[model samples]
Target: MIDDRILVKNVLAGDMQAFRLLIRQHEKLVAHMIGRLVKKDEEREELCQDVFLRVHEKLGEFSFQSKLSTWIATIAYRYAINHLRKQKIRFADLPDEESFTKHFIEETDPESIVEEGDTDAFVLKLVDELPPQYKTVLTLYHVEGMTYPEICEVTQMPEGTVKNYLFRARNLLKEKVKKYLGKEELL
Candidate 1:
């Protein structure tokens, strides 16, 4: 595997192949992040492409202050938010605090589930159902293991706000999972 820093340096130095390598390395992460935010399959693919395009255009501006992934995620977050705002979608309607808490508790705690399969798929499904803000925080913090500060940098939010969002996002996921599992029991 090529070093990310080296790849970035090459891309900045005008090596087209290096840019391709960087895209190949991070495409899946960008795609998954976009998928969680965009409900429409076609739009999601377009947004994913737009993200890479922006990344290429902005490569020279990267200061190496954060991980390349974090930098790319920041771009994806902003692009996704812009797309939603253009559609006049409000972030407030994403998910409630209670619902997120319930889902997190039910899904994250392995003991809550009786059957063990590929919970990843189910988890992704639930995540996709989350509001953009909540989903972004969950994906950045939990899925990508980004530091709170990194998340703040990516989302362009204050540190405290990032922490609060993460807390709320987890809570909301727990709530959704609990409700989902509860419904399964009834069926």
Candidate 2:
């Protein structure tokens, strides 16, 4: 794990290795947020690069207020949302965030568990189907292992809203996963 203090210090001092290390440590977090928001691969990749470049430029202003990851994720969120707006991206059938069924399936066949290697990818696909806010909350909270306050820092949502989004996203995912596993009838 890269130590935030040292990495930030070295990065500010013009150490190329430290800069690379910072990117290595936080690139996945940026990618997850960017991937969730930006649909086009080429555009996503460009946005990701842009995110790091901005991070590099702004490293000097980083106050030790929250975890470095949270700060980076906030930047990523703004950039992706800005990109989405600039491109005027449109969806024909955007799912309603309020439409998620409360009745999630509780059980699946023991044999239905995904093969070990593919489970993460499978879960991510299900997560990808979530509405943007829910998915961003889930990724920042669960995937990035951030606390509610940290999530709030990145998302600008109230603490209660963060908790609600996390709960609702999980419930939505559970319903979808169980349905995918042929357990829809059991819900």
lDDT of 1 at 30: 88
Per-residue C-alpha lDDT of model 1 across residues 34-124, encoded as one tens digit per residue? 7777789899889999999999999889888888998998888788878888888876574455665555555454433435565676677
- In model 1, where do residues sit more than 4 Å from their true spots? 93-118, 179-187
- Provide the lowest-lDDT 10-residue window in model 1: 105-114
Give one digit per residue, the lDDT tens place, for model 2 in 1-187: 7679999999999999999999999999999989988888999999999999999999999998888988999999989988977888642235454444532233322234365546667777667766788889898877789999898888888999899878988877766767666666544
Q: Please give the CA lDDT of all the candidate structures.
A: 0.77, 0.81
Q: How many clashing pairs does model 1 include?
A: 17
Model 1 gets an lDDT of 0.77
TM match of model 1 to true structure: 0.78
Query: How large is the C-alpha RMSD of every model relative to the true structure?
Result: 5.2, 4.7
